[model samples]
Target: MNINKEENHVQSVVRAAHILQLVANSDHPITINQLSEETNLNRTTVWRLLETLEFLHYVERDLPTKGYQLGYAPYRLFSKNNMYLSLIRKARPLLEKLRDEINETVLLSVPKHNGTLTIDQIDAPHSIRPINLVNRLLPSHCTSNGKLLLSRLSIEEFNLILDRELEPITRFTITDPTLLQEELNWVRDHGFSLSLREWDESENGMSVEITDNRNELIGFISLLGPYQRLSKDKMLTLAPKIKSTAKEIAEKLS
Candidate 1:
């Protein structure tokens, strides 16, 4: 997505790939002239690349109208790595929409070992929004998303997570295994978790689990922000909305 690339990045290939994407995104087949005008490339160059893509069955060219459409190659390439990609693609747009509704940073995360791993984030435009935590392993015992994941664990697995040293990441972090286990039980009973600065002193986080068609836990959708804005009570009130959005995302996988 970064247009400003390194010197080694080939311009022709990038342009061709962009054009191919443009075609794939279009609702209908596109003309060569439109592709040229959109990319600001010469008609001849666009034609050459389209011809190559068509030959490889990565593009479908209309013989009579001289139009082009996205071919099966792209779908085949992506569908092979479907599970995570499917979840992310379906979750991202909804996460952005939820960010607009609540005006808070939203995140999608999954369990990774005994921790919560953020898969995506849609940061609120507010200057005071919490920092993005995508790809980070959040502490399991003290974070809302982490506890949401841990609450779904089997008895043996739950014991394993509890057996690990529950170090305090922040002043408010629950370092006692019994207390953390009690919190997880509460989360399981209430169907949601809202933590007040257990990860960071000034921030609060809320999480709701997403389930598959079979009602199995898939991941979690979370909101993160300053305690002043996302106070425990305020987050508690938003819990239903967050769970609703997570359910909508679950429906997509079915």
Candidate 2:
């Protein structure tokens, strides 16, 4: 084919790929008109591309909404590994970099139904670092990751969860719902969370949320280490670095 024709064909393929991605990431199924508006293409061209994608099982159209959504083929291709595993894989390098920079134990965590769960961790390269709590459920009232995730909840949801007895995990743990709310409020305002020896007197954690493109909190990255060295002032100083690392991971998720 001529160079001009070949270039036009490649551009068309790129546009089609963009269309498939838009359908995959949309919050809800999207209509042809919406796709055209988003892609700056006419309805006829978008419809032709959607027809080809539907034939290939890359996307499917909804009868009721007349909208397009990702098809089973995409899930089949991605299901080789679980989503969490993929996230961890994508985040490992960033986590390692953060740990090396701060020289503190770095952990990745996501919120659970009743509490928060640690998904992955990299131990600090120091001799007397904090305990590694991998694949463990942690109390939400005191830990930095827990509070950072909790800060995403609406007031009513937060109140409902806090209605239970707030057990004190350590001498410094916050056992009062009102006081914890204040802390969570501060976390939301400051864009980070602090454990301050609440989970364990020997360890302190500083955390920031990994928010997606929509600005929704999906997970968080935290730095935990010996409280003697990772003091409140030090945590504050490292907060920006941790937040930058989390932002890098979040962009990958997007």
Compared with the true structure, all predictions reach lDDT values of 0.85, 0.85
Error at 62, model 1, angstroms: 40
- Residue 144, model 1: lDDT of 91
What is candidate 2's local distance difference test score?
0.85
Each candidate structure's TM-score, on Cα atoms with residue i matched to residue i, is 0.66, 0.67
Candidate 2 residue 103 Cα shift, in angstroms, is 0.7
Clashes of 1: 0
Give the alpha carbon lDDT tens digit for every residue of 179-253 in model 2.
Answer: 888898899889999998898888888888888888876888988888889899999988888888988898887
Candidate 2, superposed: residue stretches over 4 Å from native: 1-82
